[model samples]
Target chain A: MGGLAVIEVVALDGDDTLWHSEQMFVDTQARFRDLLAPHVDLDHAALDARLLEVERRNLSTLGYGVKAFTLSLIETAIEVTEGRVLGRDVQAIVDLGKALLDHPVQLLDGVPEAVDALTGRYRVMIITKGDLLHQESKVARSGLAEDLWAVEIVSEKDAPTYERVLRRHRIDPASFVMVGNSVRSDVLPVLALGGRAVHVPYHVTWELEQPDHDPADGDFPVLAGLTHLPACLEAMGAEAA
Target chain B: MGGLAVIEVVALDGDDTLWHSEQMFVDTQARFRDLLAPHVDLDHAALDARLLEVERRNLSTLGYGVKAFTLSLIETAIEVTEGRVLGRDVQAIVDLGKALLDHPVQLLDGVPEAVDALTGRYRVMIITKGDLLHQESKVARSGLAEDLWAVEIVSEKDAPTYERVLRRHRIDPASFVMVGNSVRSDVLPVLALGGRAVHVPYHVTWELEQPDHDPADGDFPVLAGLTHLPACLEAMGAEAA
Candidate 1:
């Protein structure tokens, strides 16, 4: 057991961790590239970089969400095409945003079993960040609502944000473990606050969510997938015991 | 004082309640009308009506806030203009949304005084509903952050939402009071839950926020302005005492 603290609560990130989400963004970005193909001679990679630039510029004003992404796409189209982009194409981008919002909630393999396994033994909750209404709707549609202790949809997942959430819920960081797909968001912040974190990498990550340095730079356990989460936590529990 | 419940907490609705917000929406609506005039022969009133229709239709999908408003505006332009609206016009609507986001948070007259008057006598907090990041940023800019005990930015202000917030914070409905500008959001929900509410009408209200019928249909005190809030609460306190 050494000096390790026993984990009492397990908190997981919503997007990409429990469900297929980043893949939708990837598909939408592809659709965006296709829509611009006729108006611009640039490669897909170059166009994506330009849209990313617009997103970065608008981030402070628009924050984060499908709406922000859609706005950036429209702006990028307008800029790259030099106003030659037709209004119908602009409308297509808006439809893309709508489709993303109305996308069905698809749970990843082993998600329900992992949550069920952890439910009785530990306080399981979801701590996700994004557009509030959109996230709330997704949680409602996820069918995991009745099994969790609490659900917090924050605007960001920084160290201070994590600290505030933990304090508000009266959960000690020493006994808290955050499992998610983004190391920059769900992993690093929790670890910085003296908490435990498990990384479950998704197949495709949003460029903005990627960490500049190698995620392996951090001292945390990495799981092959969510199916491996329960066993990993149990081993840690044994060590603490 | 017989049977009257003593108020222990004072919660306020942000936006048009503590600051000028609806007027900005009104002004933006005017600009939207102007942008469409060249492409369509419809009068301002008809154009405004069409835009409202689009907003109502998109509410469930887009929820609320500047982003939602902007999306609706873009969609309306495309529909009414019959594909004649230029990309530049769509870009103009996006700029309008950005301006709304960047608009200075102007505290209504005597707001600071009213909040200050209520501060030490009771636990003061803000219960605002809108985009999470946008609402949070507005709070930070409002200069009233230090005076509030807590701030809740929710997606909607329905009865269930109020109940969840009150129960989570361990606040008794009998001892709570909500003050705001929207009768539908700030008044009806609290009153339905046996909590008291005070309505302080703003000069301009968003059509969506307006109640279906007369707001006086409900049983609650109505103040002429925020400056009178402290005195009204004190009288309620005396009655309960």
Candidate 2:
């Protein structure tokens, strides 16, 4: 095909790409801080740092998802309170995690249209990293499952993961385009594999998911929002074709 | 191929089939029952029944895995104790879940050799369900990653799920053979997909995974253990060939 049609497959990230998720996490963290307020003297900043530390330590063992986040929250609560944290408070934290898991999946404006537009000319898939059931439920609830060709719920979104997905789907890197919110996850990895990526910034980015290196340094387009994705991909396809 | 060489692919269940998992869960449940003993008047049977009830209710929402199991444990504790459970006990439950997540994956007797033998002739994959990260970690630690063709970690094991996996991997159901411990999750689903299955009983089966109908009524073999898998598969292959 000579990579003539440089975008035969369009893979988008699930959370914060097609729908809102990190904001829910941010709100939950705020509530988590409040839940520990009366028990511990730590300010919100210190509490967040300590929680992040615990999350980092547990990341290797627990991986990521609501469950891991909840576990880290409980551990942080116990440690911050020196085991004096109240049972009711613990229950509150558990309730918060459950609520977050039960949070309704709200699609970002224009996500459905953009995905549908891209699906007309390209194979579309959701490449998300989180708990399998949780991600699957969100995708099913998002009203986009039927629009996409496949939904990949992975544990991590690194270069190897992107490579595996592409290889399994039998897509050439030169003809694959990934669109997502996280540069660290959706952009750099796909770019590393000689594929193209588009960065659409989400309002809330998880601290751990923040890109260490500036995304501007990468050779990819940063659209104003997911709404601009269709036009952007169309222009790229025209230029390549 | 005329389905002449039946059983082109052999997929094995991870938990209980390849490694000891349910016994660990059984041990954790005992500990959970003990932790709630002093806080409630319910006897062991009552507590067990209540916990199972909560698990069933949460199963649809939380799905399954150690995290779901742990969340159910904490919820059951709080409910049974009427919100009077101690923070220390909640922490204990979280710790139990973490330890289970960190549990060493002990392969069943003859698993490695059996998998190696199967891989020599047929394409082999680990088709298991649960937390994606947990299952991935167990497979990675089980020292079997280098042997198998792929590891499929699913959310639920049902007929449609089996159909999806087989269709995705381009494996014909007629040439696929599934071996696992649970008739409900492993055997029945594959059987419904027109694939052959072998039931290898684990010493301990989770209450939720128990088959309602007797497995004996199904047209599949129930082996004494995984150690006998090779011989059984060999006989079946010879019969088909």
TM-score of chain A of each: 0.95, 0.96
lDDT tens digits by residue: candidate 1, B1-241: 1244889999999999999998999999899888888899999889989999999999999998889899899999999988778878888989999999999999999999999999978999999988888999999999999988889999999999999999989998989999999999999988888888999999988889988656555578889999999889988888778
Report DockQ per prediction, comma-separated. Answer: 0.80, 0.63
Alpha-carbon shift of residue A214 in model 1 (angstroms): 6.2
Q: Which DockQ-derived CAPRI band holds candidate 1?
A: high
Which residue pairs does candidate 2 place in steric collision?
A: none
**Best model per DockQ:** 1
Compare the candidates by TM-score and give the number of the best one: 1
Q: Tens-digit lDDT track for model 2 on A26-80?
A: 8999999988889889988999999999999889777889988988898899889
lDDT of 1 by residue, A51-100 (tens): 99999899889988888888888899989998888888999999999999
**Tens digit of per-residue lDDT, candidate 2, span B1-241:** 2443567899999999999999998899899988988888988889989999999988977888998899889888888888888778888998899899999999988888888888898899999998898999999999998989888999999999999999999998888999999989989887777788999999888889988766454588899887788889888888888
Worst 10 residues of 2 chain A by lDDT: A1-10
Q: Tell me the fnat of candidate 2.
A: 0.60
Q: lDDT for each of the candidates? A: 0.90, 0.88
- Please identify model 1 stretches exceeding 4 Å from their true place: A1-4, A214-217, B1-4, B214-217
Q: What TM-score, over all chains together, does every model reach?
A: 0.96, 0.94
Error of 1 at A171 (Å): 1.5
